[model samples]
Target chain A: MSTSAAERAVNYVILIVFAAFALAPIVTVLAAALSPQSGAESAGLAGLHPGNFVDAWSEGEFSRYLRTSVLVAVTVVSVAVIASILSGFAFGTMRFGGSRVLFYLFLLGIMVPAEAIVVPLFYDLREVGLTNTLWAVALPQIAQSIAFGTYWMRAYFRTSPPSLIEAATLDGASPRRVLWSILVPIGRPAVMTLTVLAFMWTWNEFLIPLVMSPNGDFRTAPLALAIFKGQHVQATALLAAAAVLVALPVVIVYLFAQRHFIRGMLEGAVRE
Target chain B: MRHQRRYLPYLYLTPALLLFGTFLLYPLVRSAQFSLFSWDGLGASEFVGFDNYVELFTDEVLRAAFGHALVLILFFSVLPLGLGLVIAAILNRGQVRGLGLFRTVVFLPQVLAMVVVAVAWRQIYAPNGTLNTALRAVGLDELTRTWLGDYTWTLPAVGMVGTWVQTGLVTVLLLAGMGRVPRDLFEAARLDGAGAVREFFAITLPSVRGEIAVALTLTIVAALKTFDLVYVTTGGGPGNSTTVPAYEVFQRAFREGAVGSAAAIAIALTAIIFVLNVIVNRIAEGREE
Candidate 1:
């Protein structure tokens, strides 16, 4: 496996080039968002400025969109985490007939792409008078998150030492109490990883909200940015600013939970 | 107590089952039923039987969409998986400084909204954008053309963006897989006079087979359902050159009011995905056994 210095230099060069290509577009948008003018015709490296951000904020209705996005993502993540913990504990710890079958059935949700179901989901939601409501967005996402969250927490619980659960059971802890007091306390890392992932995904989701609630009132950040793109195709600087605003939450989440994100991805890939 | 124990598993599964049936399973069946009848979002339905499926097979536009998806599979799945493995290997060897920063930068695209990625890349691929400018600067002016707007190259160009966004995920997955390879295996190879390339093919590649399979499956699935990027960047335009199956489905159901046709397309796409998944899982299982 030994390599000469020249070969090593070549390897580094390749890595650097690939990294640059990977990051170029994102960096370009950040630059665009900071630029001055608000038209694609005038946009370029020379037009780069920060003043367009203020204009974009007002014109894109980004503040309101941001509020909606945060509310939806937080609610989805919170509900998903709690529901998953309960279900994961029950499936992982309690032995009963059809447990494995039911678990696999739940995993089937992973394969059912949202695109395939949007039509019916739209009709069903409209029937319930839930269309254009935040509940429409949050409920579906919570449903989707349960599959992965349950799978993840189940993995976490299976790997946990049995002595703890047994000890809790012997101490007169009910199944619910054991989950709340014993399992959840030890499942913090897995919970945090799931939370970060769920938050990022729910925040970035576009199609669900787009079809479920197209009204400007219920528009999430990504949907808002999309609508902004359609209406303001000529407003390049403002679009860039809105794009940056849309990306900010994910960027911040990555900065704080980069390691956990990596861990979560790796863990999911390896296990499945 | 025995009866309680017997019901406990169902109890545990009730929440997931309810959600899955309502959201995932029910929609799947309903969409299938919808595919047998013609209806708009607001109007009366008429049973059209298998006409929708037949039309999907015969329609030139739908055929082109499938073709585009196949092309995208090359850019999104095949190329990304190959290049990602190379990048992951180099990073694993400690050949690059600031490895953590590099990993973070590469993975940044996966977190960004597709709309944002599309907007940024669309600018870069514009007629007088960075790509063309770079080509001209390198004395390759003749090669310079509108990257996205051009009919012949639009699909490939869009696929390339997909490759960029996805390579990071593939690289990180492979890198994690590589970490699981025993360091002593490489040390042993070096002692036996194995060179870098030989060691990679023999020691590194074989050891990370599971990861390669995982990366391939993920990238393949992502490629098949690619919509947002294409929708934002091209709208499957320039005579539908960049149209993919998912985009076609969206256009039919929403824009064209062809609900039955769209559902048929979705069911067909799902079948294709399911078959691929089974094939991949079987290969992985075979390797394990």
Candidate 2:
């Protein structure tokens, strides 16, 4: 594993160059977001300003999309997490008939893309008068989230100790109490990873919202951005600012819990 | 009363199963059924009996979309994997400065929303965007054009964005795999006068075979299931040059009302992905032999 200083220097140079390639577009867009559109490309960062964001925000009206995104995200996370925890606990602890088959049945959800079900799903939802509503978006995502969520939580639950369950049962705690009171508390890291992942997946989800909630009344940020971009393709500076605005929350979340996010991705890769 | 405990698992599973059945299972079953029928989503249905599947096979546009997605695999999986191997080797083979910072910077795109990424790349590919500007500065002005708008270059251009987003993912994954390589093997290889490149081919590459398979699976799937990126940036424009199966499926079903063929394309795309997953996993697990 030992190497010469010169070799290490070469490695650093290659690493730094590729790293710049990775980040150059991001920096350029951010710079463009800050620079006014009046300046030519050769102007070279002169006449930079923050007014584009203000202009994009007022013009794009991302506030509504943000609200819908938060609502869908919160609803999907809480509902799916609870269901996954319960089902995962049962699958982990009990010898139930047809459990293995049922587990695989749900795993099918992850294997299939939104394209597969979305076409017919729109009809089913419309027949029930739920199309163009947040519930239409929220319901399918809850199902999608739980599909992966159950697998994640089940992996954690199977590793939980039997003695903890026994101790809780001996204390006369109900099964639900035993889960929320004992095992859920112990499985905090796994739950957090699952929560963040489900949040990210549902928040960044575009296809479902694109199909299910075509009405502007219930659309999320990414969808709004697409619609916005179509209408204002010429507004480069404003579009760049809107792009940054849409990405800000996710970047903030990544900066805070990157370790968990990356860990979840690596572990999820094998199961995936 | 004592026998009721036998139903506890079912009780716990009921909520998840109900939702999964209603939302996931039922809809998939319907897509399969809908593929056999010619219905405009709102009118009386006419059963066409596999006509849609036949059309899916014969359709030239659908085939091009699939072919374009395959080329994207080159950019999304093959190119990134090669790039990943190099960078991961450098980062792991020696003590590099700020490895953590470099890793984070490289992976930043993967974390950003694809919508955001598509929008950013749209600007970078614009006529007067950064790449052209740089090319001008370096006297390589002839090499510049509107990247995502040209019919010939649009798919590759879109694919390059995929490459940019996926490289860090593959690198981090390969680096994680490389960390698991036995230390003594490298030392022994080096002591035997094996050069760095030779050591990499002999030791590092062979050992991280499973990680390579995993990386291929994830990125291949991403490339195949690419909808939002294409949707946001090109919308399958420039005369269908940038179209993919996912985008085509959406257009056929939602836009053109070809419900039967749309369902057929959707199922075909899913079948391709599923087959790829099985094959990739087989390769990943086949190392046991």
Candidate 3:
């Protein structure tokens, strides 16, 4: 694990350069959002200050936007995780007829871009009076997440020991009881990975909310940020503040669950 | 009677199936039917059979939009592959410093909403933006122009945003793959007087062949289905210069109410994405041997 000092220094220089490239715009945003100057011309830490966040929060109604986003993410994650686990356990454990075909059907959610079906889905939702409702967003997202979730959890369940399930069943536990009592705890890593991913994806989703919740009243933070940008085209500071507000939750969530999120995405990428 | 209990699998899968069927599968099927007709998405419509599909190929703007997405693959996939490999090679070096922090900062964009990225980059590319400011500071004042507004630079400018967002992903994936390469192999390579560049090719490159495919699939898909970045940054603007397939689908369907044409383009876009995905998977699998 040894390298010459020159080589080590070279690595650091490379890392620092790419890091600056990656961090520059985001740091500029942070500066712009915090700057006291409205629509600041320069992008630096010179004018950096706070209070724009307060203005953005109140004026942009980000509180409401954040609430709607949280509701959609929580609803989708809860429903998707539970459903995926149940289905995952079934697919992973039981030797059932048509399971492969059915599992492929679930994966169809992952295969098709939401954009492909979104336009038609808008009309379908309208036909059923579900348009602009939270369900419109949560339901489609849940379907999408479960496609990935089941794929993920199924791998975990399929790979994990069968003795635990066998022991639980021999002890007179029902399937639901076994999942809750034994596999759920054992499946913690997979579930954590799935939870972090679902929340991140659902929270950052724009196209669905844009197409489904055309009402602007029921939209996610990203949707809110886009619409806000239209109004504040000239107000760079305010727009930066609004962007920061929209990005804050995901950034914060990622900060906490980074290990699981990164691991899940990388592993999931390999699997795909 | 005992065999009737086999319904448990079906029962367990119902929740996922019901949601997927109602939301994803049904709509996917309906879009195909919708593509054959001219429906404004409100009133009843007469089916115009295959005409929309014909327009998807013939329409010049739609073709360019699709072409722009293909051009984006160079920035999103090819450029990132080269850049990410360099970063990965550096990070994979012995006793690298601040590795965790570097990774977190680099991967920050992936978690961020594209809207946020687009907004931030818009400021960076503005007429009096940071990019221009920096250029002027460096005494390259003549080179400073509104990046997003310049028609020639618009595509590359947007594509660069994609590269920034994706380089981290490719690097991380490559780094993870590199970690699995035996340290002894590198040691032996160095003892044979192989330089870092040689070591990267001799040992690291072959090891991450699978990851390269995965990275290619991920970035290419993002480039092709790129709506949010286009929507926020330029609105496919400075003319039709930056319009991508995903953006066209939105405009044609919702703004112009050319639902059939939009549907046709959407299907075509999906087919491209699917083919790229499968092709990458196949190539990756092929390389495994």
Best candidate (score: DockQ): 3
Compared with the true structure, all predictions reach lDDT values of 0.81, 0.86, 0.86
Instruction: Candidate 3: list runs displaced more than 4 Å.
Output: A39-48, B1-4
Ten-residue stretch with the least lDDT total in model 2 chain B: B1-10
Interface RMSD of 3: 1.8
Better of 1 and 2 by DockQ: 2
Q: How many Å off is the CA of A139 in candidate 1?
A: 1.8
Q: State each candidate's clash count.
A: 2, 0, 0
Tens-digit per-residue lDDT, B127-149, candidate 3? 99999999999999999988998
The TM-score between candidate 1 and the true structure equals 0.94
Model with the higher TM-score, candidate 1 or 3: 3
TM-score per candidate for chain A alone: 0.92, 0.94, 0.94
lDDT for B170 in candidate 2 is 95
Worst 10 residues of 1 chain A by lDDT: A38-47
Instruction: Report how large a share of the reference interface contacts model 3 reproduces.
Output: 0.75
Candidates in descending TM-score order:
3, 2, 1
